[model samples]
Target: MERFLAISPKSQLWLFHTALALNILGMVLTDMWEPMVVGAIVTTYLSIDATVRVRYVLPMKKVLRELEQENASLRRKMADVEQSSAY
Candidate 1:
């Protein structure tokens, strides 16, 4: 699960779609469908989870980056103020 989450979301979605296709093929072409069904289920879950997590995380990442930029600017301003006061 951790390893699945660690993979890129694009790759995860692609893998899920591939697994689904294979599952459908297996159902039509093979007597052995159990493994493919299981694979489809697992890949589907991973894809959904990765997409949802990425959706939640991206906005937070942007917000954190903005906050860091603001913090740096404030620090610079504080340094300038301190220097003027010393003079």
Candidate 2:
């Protein structure tokens, strides 16, 4: 909004918010349809990808590292898989 933008003029999120607001305004102001739908889809995809990386891909890395350790143990690269050591 004009108030938020006035307060923090440099924020990228605010910039995106402002653009989205302007996009909606344009749809009503010019009575366009396709552009508004495209705008909605773009923001939706960005949000979905952000959610997926934070929720799944990051945790998968830890599981992957564990699997790599297990695979290496199966190959006998480690000295002793039974030895007690801090993970």
- Compose the digit string of candidate 2's lDDT tens values, residues 1-87: 233334333353445556666777777888677978799667555445444554676578889999999998787745455454534
lDDT of 1 by residue, 1-87 (tens): 346557676677677767777777877898777877787787677667766656776667889999999999999999999999999
**Which candidate ranks first by TM-score, i.e. highest?**
1
The C-alpha lDDT values of all candidates are: 0.76, 0.62
Cα lDDT for residue 87, model 1? 97
lDDT of 1: 0.76
Best by lDDT: 1
Instruction: List where candidate 1 sits over 4 angstroms from the true fold.
Output: 1-31
Runs in model 2 deviating more than 4 A are 1-33, 77-87
